[model samples]
Target: MFDHIADAVKLPDLVRIGDNLVVARFETMKVYSALAAVEHLLNTGAVQPGDTLMDSSSGTYAYSLALACHKYGMKCHIVCSTKADPSVVTQLELLGATVEQVPIPPGPMVDKMDLEVRLQRINEILAARRDVYWMQQYHNGFHYHGYREVAALIDREMPGAPLTVVGGVGSGASTGGLATYLRELRPDVELVGIQPYESVTFGSEPVEDPVASISGIGSPVYFANVTYELYDRIHWIAHDQAVAATLALYRDHGIFGGMSSGCCYLAAEWEARQNPDRQFLFIGADTGHRYMSSVYTKHDQAVSLTGLEPRGIRELTELELPWAVMDWNRRPYEVAPKVLPC
Candidate 1:
């Protein structure tokens, strides 16, 4: 019975954004990946039944890990950012997982330093326990393998068309792994990566991104999973741009996706316009229900969509599009593994 619930997590609803754009809304994609990781460890005898599974997540992955532990009768301890959604935190606790919420430092954007602080807390927890296994999402290649099924679904659903896969680059498992698998079948399929304005993923000079209302899409630190070569191009979407696109998606398509989804949607929209014949596919990482308080309820629906007048959907591509564009070959940041204490 629990196995069925675990299995159901992988299948997400695919929705159309426009004529040439589609979003694979992974309302619980992280759950699928997290469960896969834990099961792999258990089956391989890498971890025992009573052992605790630990990791740091912003929100979605924390819920995923907690659910996985609950299904498998294992202990789960999560070190998450204070920015994590309250609803997600409540769910994690209700699932019987212990959570430690680390306070984020005052900054316009979340950066490597913030992640380092979280890592410090996680390390502290790990140091206290001998039977804990860290499902390091950013560096774990196992995380990449879980997404092969996602690529298969995309291929099975949309076969035989020039395709461009686009998504926000977080752990690189979702976007990088999907692109890697898809390319194995169709080498010509284009891969585009999206990040927030302050993210260094595409080598944009780090700045305080006051507008980054979303988490999970952009990283302050360089992660090993984000293979720079896997992408054809990268675009940096601003916080306001993401917010505008997110609200527009809800109003126009009735798709209530998170900010990262909006960022990918905006990029996919641009890519679709550039190549009308090709299908632009992007990942809707999660739903916006968790963001209702800060994102939806706080803003005026009418003004949120129309306030950015000159920079509205009409000028999305021309003006409000990528703050910076980088070809994969010419990216500024060195793609190397971050040396962490964990």
Candidate 2:
């Protein structure tokens, strides 16, 4: 039995979608990251009980950190993006976490600007409050520790299997952390990262998705925690395609997951079809409840999943809209000049 709701929520439900494709689904995947990070901080005396843990989030990490703080008698303060769902903000407040929504700026780069504003606010908060500890989910190495247990679970579940992990690369903790530990057991394990159009994380910044930033998956800013070398391939998906895949996922497989899950599903399904001999695993980062109004309600605009496929390209400059994939070959890109230890 789990000791707390955070413990219960952090565990993923491994569900097989196809004969070779499996999805490690979570209520809020970052609970694992936040729990481990908080525990480590407390043990190391970086933070004490009742000290406020602050972080910037679109939604998922905010909820996870709040739950982690609630479980350990710590306080949580969230500097949220304008894109953060109203439902999530409500939950954060109810959980006793202080919330501040960054103002939506006027421009084409709203997503990027929102993140910059949030980070700026965080800097200001850190300067003023000595008791407030910035969680720095995007840069903290402690965030990666929790996923080692997940890797162990996968190793036990799929012993001696040739695995290709496909998932969204957000702060990079979930996909990067999982692959880092999984590689220790199977050196040949492949990791395919999914990103939304316009996310600078994997060189899709040139192109813009009309409906941009799929919550927790892609980022407008560079994440130090994202170990670029961990990815063997990267796929960029547009908003419409993710919506279609999300709708089809529930209609066909009954897994009601978020936008990141939808994007990962598309990549995983395609990869599974291409390499029938290999096993494919994708991550369902969170449930679709938060995306109901923003994504699910626009089901009429969603396209069919059958005809959809990623256009394979050799260079990052050749990135196109809707969907695209590149063979990253487990090499770090120039954008991430200094590789952070995994």
Candidate 3:
């Protein structure tokens, strides 16, 4: 029934794991956003079918955009992060995408600098080539449009129940887009965002994780598309705990997902236990193959989730290691001034 693999991959499996927990597991979740964005550009004449689409990504978005381009007859060029998986790069190249990785900087604590360099390189490319269109996945509103259909599906499946949607606050589009559309159908939809330590998105910059860059979940750059008002609560997960949760998800439910998925699962499980009256649905953004060596191989080292508990805090200043959660209350917060070099 689907014309392309991209169409088929975008469909998620909604599986109920507990009395109150449901997971919307995706193979590559961002394909929906990329496909919809590309189609819109073509339909509106903003971009022609043969045009080259460019963007900076760590992994999932790169693959997603390449798949979209292959489906729609557009060309894709990705400025990849230093942390991008080798398997992903191979796939992107095979799918006809031109990839250029920003070099890993010298010394420790290179996460923030690497991101800045990627954006700077993107600008250089834009300056040299007028024909190439930058998708600006992090700042573009078009990325949000793709999740409307997903919201409708969730609405129909879990009708008239108090629902809490949880996922990583990556570009802010995934969870933000879902909450935006879901609220239209039924107000009072609670939104929970999972973040990694040291990400500035939720003011966790004060605490730096030595592990640093957990690709696809946290970022060193500021994203314009992350609507601060959409989040009702936020959880900052540490890298070690994420690894444990990732292994646990496979062991417990046979769901092989990435670290971001583990972060969401860990947070959602706790949230579901806290609010038994509300039906909790968490987004599993991608599969675990990309993290086989980085995360899964450390299964023996992973700690038991039974002894772990997040310290609930009233303010961002109280955030600390292992895990922390705060009530954002769907309130808007000012984006901090950018101090990273451009």
Candidate 4:
């Protein structure tokens, strides 16, 4: 008697942002948008319910997967680093999912099966369970170009303004696929690939110590999606600068966001200042509420994500942060493409 709930990314309104000035209103569409796309991919006569989903992430998406699993009563085995935000973890548990904590230190090389290996390890864990649906955002070439839908909408909404898109990645799907789509629509567009100070797997890498500030993007190793074919230029953001920028946005604009989002937002600000005629556009992957112990919160609280990444610095706020939580920007992230398993 009622309409069934479909995926999140497919809805026309969900794919585009209506507001330009206020961020909160604009971000509402992102969760459903990403989910819709992911679900559509699954519905392609391939995936089904009751299959275990193995997703590894250091941020909010892992939790989102847990909730998505609830709809089909699928088992969710999430791989998270010691460095992963606590709020992300809490939500997964609430959805009756399991979280495996990575144990290790940086750089010695994490075995894809090592608990500390995060997504790489989740790939291994699900290997033993044939019924497990391992969804890697990487190998799946069928990118919905969710960003393109948003970008075109933004361009149309704000005419006479140049659109500059910037962000970092490990899966590199957003950077590559979105760039390809936007360039087709607006050849003069500038798609900026933001990398951390260290891991420049693609593009002309910046000169800096280690170079990568974000763990997922700028990986020391080349990821499946981060190919050379996808970008106009590369911009590097310092870890501290991204942290500072995120804090500044929270203080000034009251926009609580994650690291990659922070990088894109700062780059957008720089673009807006450089080309006043352009209306800068960027992606906000998730809310910063998940990051209470780190850059998203106070300053100087201690926490661990895993050995492959740095330990988090705690914020000094007296607020008791939950180990994990979920809000709007939550969605699934795959290290590889999400394809169906028999």
My TM-score estimates for the predictions, one after another, are 0.87, 0.95, 0.97, 0.69
Give lDDT: candidate 4, residue 226: 60
Alpha-carbon runs more than 4 Å astray in model 4: 1-37, 71-73, 105-116, 143-145, 203-212, 296-342
Which regions in candidate 2 have their CA more than 4 angstroms from the true location?
A: 336-342
Q: Give all candidates' CA lDDT scores.
A: 0.75, 0.87, 0.89, 0.53
lDDT leader: 3
Model 3: residues >4 Å from true position, as ranges? 340-342
lDDT of 1: 0.75
Candidate 4's residue-wise lDDT over 159-234, tens digit each? 5555656556556776565557777777666666666643435321223443234654565444566655456555
Best candidate (score: TM-score): 3
Question: Ten-residue segment with the worst summed lDDT in candidate 3?
Answer: 333-342
Error of 3 at 307 (Å): 2.6
lDDT of 2 by residue, 116-234 (tens): 77877888988998999998998899999999999999888876559999989988898999999999988879999999887778878779777655757877677889888899999
Model 1, span 1-342: residue lDDT tens: 535565776678888768888988877778767877888888989999978999988688888888889888999998887767777788888889988888878874355656888998877877887988988988887777777788888888887678998888888888877888888878778888887755555544334566442468766666777777788777776777677788877777888888888878777777788799898898888889877876777557423434232222221133333354555642335733543322
In order, how many clashes per candidate?
1, 0, 0, 45
| Candidates arranged by TM-score, highest first | 3, 2, 1, 4
Off by over 4 Å in 1: 104-113, 301-322, 329-342
